[model samples]
Target chain A: MSGVKKPVERRLRGEAVPALDVARIRADFPILDQQVYGKPLVYLDNAATTQKPRAVIDAVTRYYEHDNSNVHRGVHALSQRATEEYEGVREKVRAFLNARSVRELVFVRGATEAINLVAATFGRMRVREGGEILLTEMEHHSNIVPWQLLAEQTGAVLKVVPITDSGELVMEEFERLLGPRTRLVAVAHLSNALGTINPVRRIIGLAHAQGVPVLLDGAQAAPHIRVDVQDLDCDFYAFSGHKLYGPTGIGVLYGKEKWLEDMPPYQGGGEMIRQVSFKRSTYSDIPAKFEAGTPNIAGAIGLGAAIDYVQAIGLDAIAAHEHSVLEYALAAAEEVPGMRVVGCARAKASILSFVLERIHPHDIGTILDRQGLAVRVGHHCAMPVMEHYCLPATARASFAVYNTREEVDVLMAGIRKVREVFGQ
Target chain B: MNDLRDLYQEVIFDHNRNPRNCYCMKGANRTAEGFNPLCGDRLTLYLKVEDGKIAEASFQGSGCAISTASASLMTEALKGKSLEEAERLFQAFHGRITRDTGGAAPVDLGKLEVLSGVSEFPTRVKCATLAWHTLNAALEDKGEPVTSE
Candidate 1:
């Protein structure tokens, strides 16, 4: 691993902390070197999806070029090598999330699928017709829709905890809503649209007090925060690899050993069963029970490489660097007249969601695209949050480890150009 | 910035800032709502038809500059036109914006031709045509809201 202290050493010496060697970090991501619309590309859409480093790219390429075989059932040498690489990634993911065991982690398509798996299996088993599934207003659609489907199927009611105007969760309301009928409490660890870092540890504690299992949607958190599922004691945690600078089509769902054992298999397919017969079939244990058919072997290996890449730089360093950059951006935003930031939580991450006066987000997005600043402009799949704010959409600029203060300046300049275009 | 300028021309900015007849018309015989799910742009079209001709047209909604301008200009161009002419104009406007000129004789779109730049931005074509789609739905009396998916 890279020297973790070298990046933040100045802080220890009572001096101004030096920024991460972003030049070196930027060099590792080959996609960051490209140009768009005759200007150097400034990618601020990390919340939507992060760009992959060359290490991850090469790991996936090497897998497809050399070790190309199905996992587990292969008796050939190539198959054995592929299975070793594939299974090794499970251990890496376990360590990345600091989970109890690799068996507790199941590889799914993405965070969306991981939540669906929990909702389909655990939700189907635990929630009764009158049971309540509690959620927050800031949850992404992935976390909300699955439970809605479960509620629709079982006639269970979905109770929502509201957020404050500054995008912080109303903790008192959450405590009040954790009633006797509440079976599950699912919420986002970090708001994708608002950049609010939710107090998931407290949320888990309250839910555990009520004997309710809390499932955390870490799709936005895992990329920026240090996620220790054990420390938080969350019953379930989910995150996508793509947002963590890894490949798409692969993610991790970390459930407690007991929960994984109690929940039925999400899908029945080859390799998930121990023995098939004419009568009934028994399923394999935990991870294998959830992973059905041919998995994304290369994606898993690439995710392992991604974990290694981020670990070497250190999560603390990444978080500190992104936090400083976000702070800088927020301060710079004050210079732009008529600029209104949508979310102003006391604690936030690398995302900056804001709106310029009267100019629509789409127009801002198009103008920024011409200036080679890629920002996400929409409701960010959190329509309820938009409705709460009485806005159709807001332009979002999310930062990653590779983002620099200079790029944030360019973004601010792009907003000024948008104002010029709209005659604001 | 030429393309940006073309997409958000001064005229577009003007209409977006100060839309004409941008209100719910009273005593409207035909009304329909349009929704662009991609960007959450929505508008309601109000038309007053008399003796097979449109006597008044107006709309009220929130959308991007391109969409707002297209809607405002559409209300101006569509007034005092027969239903048949409106349909033909829809076809011509759609054809011009979508670049689907399959050897059909081109119809003069007049002021609406400024939106021809939308063809370059395939994504914004929906924004440009949302008002026209609502007009179509209003004329047909399709009570259901039209969606540009």
Candidate 2:
């Protein structure tokens, strides 16, 4: 469990990494195999961004080294190869999300851009004066702000579904919030600040029953669990590549074909144009219609490689191991006097958001980082959740496929040091 | 990790846990709110100025050890000093913590010199300066909330 010289490469197609072999899995992320402050690095910030596997880094390097060219417009060999690889990733993402067709998958910069795209187009199309857009208090700013912008423009009111003291959403309150004026409902599939896995499927069902479309922000969910957009029946889904062990500047926005067709193009540019004139410019069909620019070609290929890496490891194994680690982390952190775990949803992923008595989360983060344990602090870009608890901020430690119990112990020790510094 | 010791000295921890003047001053004439939104450190500094001198300085807020300690020490340093003298000490103290040593000292920071270690932790510079900026705001009668971005 201490040292793994190499990652396990040869395996049955769907064979999961054994729980005891997390060290071997950790070896694949080269960035994890390092020291900080002369101590072994303990990275617990997976929710913010997961470190890339060798496969993803190699894929990006391979793309740049061998086939570096722009896609969709080139007739040359390099251009054609680049286009194929870039487009190939679209199909891979389609399969990863289990979307109905490649036409449903639109590649954008990241979840932020994807949501903004939908808010600018689908939101503008549907939301109207005095109409409502429903959201939850657990939403990240990315999910909240874009809708706020659209509401400001269209005079649409933004209604928030409150969360319980335990950080879980109030189902009855959600039912109450769902009304005739609700034009759209956007919420997080998994809370990035809290580890609560929302009942998006049921939420989607409720919204669709009211003839209102739903968008699930899967930026935090895509990395942790298996998500099938078709099975969930969400009208739209958004997720980032960086959080899924892929490179930055690439993400996916999955919208139903009908909505994608009805909504105007988010941004007009060369690739998304059917025909271009000063008077009127018709748009391309489906996914291409939403994706306007040249796009993150290398980032798309790298994301494909990341998806392959996760599929090979098996998400079931990842989930089981992460759940155990989170349990251990929660218990260990709670043992410290005055320690309070912020999110206590019965159903949660692998995030431990907590605060020690009289210690600022940023100070805790700084001390933990000194011990080479990276944890996220502050509001986790979900200020509404913090406001709900009347807390200024929280310290968060999130686990991933490659994290081990040993790393969790290191984090616990670092937290103890924080307690000592505060003299608690 | 050894350098962290320099950043979180015993003096800082003691002051952080039991900050001096850690409340709103009664009959305070000048007051301003300071916020470091990135790290969620927020403080309100109150100054009682009499004859252009700070008769009292107090604060109320929540922040990291460095920030709480800095604000605590800043209140101690600012009390009984004239407005111009307080501003001069602010410059010297700011220079010491920020490692901008080129500025000549108008007044010795004394106990505030413990914060000299903060310069090494570039991210913490804002934490140490939040109080001073708020004091600056209070002195100028600027009611706008001071933000150390």
Question: Pick by TM-score: which candidate is best?
Answer: 1
**CA error at residue A41 for candidate 2, angstroms:** 0.5
Docking class of 2: medium
For model 1, residues A22-59, the per-residue Cα lDDT tens digits are 99999999999988989999999999999999999999
Runs off by more than 4 Å, candidate 1: A1-18
* Share of true Cα-Cα contacts across chains kept by each model: 0.82, 0.75
B1-149 per-residue lDDT for model 2 (tens digits): 67888988889988998999998778999999999877788999988999998999999998888899999999998889999999888878878877785856445678887888899888889999999889889888997999766
Model 1: what is its DockQ?
Answer: 0.85
DockQ values, each candidate: 0.85, 0.74
Q: Candidate 2 chain B: worst 10 consecutive residues by lDDT?
A: B100-109
How many collisions between residues are there in candidate 2? Answer: 0
- Top lDDT: which candidate number? 1
- Model 2, C-alpha of A384: deviation from truth (Å): 1.4
Give the Å error, residue B23, model 1. Answer: 0.9
